[model samples]
Target: MSETYHIPVLRDACLEGLNIRPDGTYVDVTFGGGGHSKALLERLDNKGRLYAFDQDAAAAEQAQKLATYPQFQFIQANFRYIGKFLRLHGVRQVDGILADLGVSSHQFDTAERGFSIRADAPLDMRMDTAAPLTAAEVLRTYSEAELHRILGMYGEVRNAKTLANALVRARQQAPIATVAQLKAVLEKHAPKHREFKYFAQVFQALRIVVNEEMGVLEEFLGQCASLIRPGGRLVVLSYHSLEDRPVKNLIQKGVLFGEPEKDVYGNFYKPFEALHRKPIEADETELAANPRARSAKLRVAVRTEDGVR
Candidate 1:
């Protein structure tokens, strides 16, 4: 695991949530630089199998280092296809699944990837470089209304409508082909003291759309309900509310969008039980070391027998 690639947020808490058994099988659905996977491998016995997934080409290089472990298998694919990939490996059920969602530090630090507000690069923010849709394409193709919705919902930008209008107007004059152009066009609208923060939100919104993060998260969480054993655990670390909200609802209420409907007994028909009443955040020490951990929210859920039935 490359320390510079990404530091696993809430590592101790995530491992505790897993309640790892010496011989149990587990999956790390977002391998990134294999930080969490390597940590999991340390806790597992020789018989305990660990499967990891990542679609990024760069992550494939990191995955190769973990190939030395006999109990480890690395699948180069998006975690949304976790069930199919695991089934292909003859793993029908796993004791635990861990997903550290959102973009990795390596992705942001790489200038060519265009995932950072601080970097001036091509408007391409695909987690999988092989992915077809680029941020440039989204900016050029999406309607004003589409931009408004994504900026508001995914980025939580304060003036999404104004920003959307500004983007549309700027693109009409000349294509917004780079991060520098984007920042230049929207600079006037940014708050006087927090220009970089505003740019960060805009870039985040673009990255989410380019990566299809929300849709993939919904698909992955649905599979977790069925793939985990009755007593198994599902631990997720998400970077924003857009990702965390659905995870919370799915774990607590078994529904993606809202409160689950209750039966006459007033018990909600849910697949898993939330291990924590509220999402966990990183400690002050961790926050001081890695400011990125400040936005991270960790949630743990235990699959129930009722879900399997």
Candidate 2:
């Protein structure tokens, strides 16, 4: 894998969170540039097995470099189906699972992928290139209310309703098929000095919806409790609150949303125990080295014996 493909954020911290065992089986669900997987292989002996997944074709190409390692295997699919894919390989349970969520640097840098607000490319932000939905399609087909909800919930955009109306109005005149066209529509509604941030928020919302990111994350998290062996680790590095909230809730409450279910004994039936009371943030050194790490939050949890089915 080319170093420029991605610089793994909080590399050491993530490895520590995984608490890797030399001969144990592991999975890196977001094998973006294989930076994390490569590092993981270095710590494992021949008996250690690592299964990595990525839907991006570019990432699959990077995974090819690690193909020579007998301990490493790459699956070209979304991590939402982690359990099913692992099961297909006869891996009923694993010792550790590491998820590094959000867009990779390579995606953003490659303007044609349309993940960056800085670029003026076709509004195609599907993480899995083969997926039917794209940012432009979402803008074209979604109802104003649907757009409003996604913007407000996913992007947390303050003027989501107003912006949604603007998009509806603008699209009537011309198709908002590219980043430049979308920005033109947004510029009129964006806060004066915060236009860039506003654009990012809008873009983020579109990307999330286009890729069904939150839904995918929820499914993957739900599977984690069952797919990991007791005492195994679940280490997730989430870039935004939308991604982090469910992870935090699952580790602390054992449910993605709302209150945890109670047993007959009146104790909550939680599957995992958090390793740290608070999620770990990038240190100043790492932040300095990779500005993208600024928003990264690392949370680690260990599967408990209590809820084993």
In order, the Cα lDDT scores of the candidates are 0.91, 0.94
lDDT of candidate model 1 versus the reference = 0.91
Mind giving the per-residue lDDT tens digits that candidate 1 earns over 176-205? 999899989879899899998888888889
The reply for model 2, stretches above 4 Å from the true place, is none
Worst ten in a row by lDDT for model 1: 300-309
| TM-score for each model | 0.96, 0.98
The alpha-carbon root-mean-square deviation between model 1 and the true structure, to one decimal in Å, is 1.6
Q: Model 1: runs farther than 4 Å from truth?
A: 264-266, 307-309
**Candidate 2 residue 48 C-alpha distance from true site, Å:** 0.3
